[model samples]
Target: MRLDKFLKISRIIKRRTVAKDFAEGERVMVNGRIAKPSTDVKKGDILTLRIGDRETVFEILDIKDNVKAAEAKNLYRIIE
Candidate 1:
């Protein structure tokens, strides 16, 4: 799945456009490298997103085209 789509489907960023813009702004990273919205997302990949002074990291656990709200979080695992 696409990085942007995964972000939205995972409810990480809430919207695909926002996720794309975040990537364009270099606020999202995959495996510690800047990643574009079109970047392919695969299981076990690490994603880092910067939000001001805060940072969030997640490990890709699964990929799904569509998931229920209750199951969205299962797509990724938060990393400490």
Candidate 2:
């Protein structure tokens, strides 16, 4: 799935546009490399999101076009 969509569907960023902007701003990385908003993300990929002075990492667990709010957390596993 697209990075932006995954972020939103997973409820990590709340909105797709915000996730796109965040990725375009170079605040996101995939597998140790900076990624764009349209980047392809798959299972097992590591994502690092820079938020101010800290970073949050997650491992993609699954991908789906749509998911219930309660099940969103199942899409990815927080690494840190």
Candidate 3:
């Protein structure tokens, strides 16, 4: 799935537009390299998001076109 779409579908960023802005502004990374809104995302891929002074990292566990709020967390596993 597309990075922005995945983020929105997974409820990570809340909205697809926000996710696109985050990626276009270079606040996102995939597998250690900078990522764009259209970057491809798949199971097992690592996602790194830089927000302000903090960095959030997680691995894609699954991909779904749609998910309920309660099930969104199942799409990724945060790596601490």
Cα lDDT of candidate 1 equals 0.95
Q: Cα deviation of 46 in candidate 2 (Å)? A: 0.2
List TM-score per model, in order.
0.97, 0.98, 0.97
lDDT of model 2 at position 51? 88
Candidate 3 is scored at a TM of 0.97
Looking at model 1, residue 80 earns an lDDT score of 55
Which residue pairs collide in model 1, if any?
none
Cα lDDT of model 2 by residue, 8-39, tens digit:
99999998999999999999999999999999
Candidate 1 TM-score versus the reference: 0.97
Kindly report which residue stretches of model 1 are placed more than 4 angstroms away from their true locations once superposed: none
lDDT agreement with native, every candidate: 0.95, 0.96, 0.95
Model 3 pairs whose backbones collide: none
lDDT score, candidate 1, position 35: 99
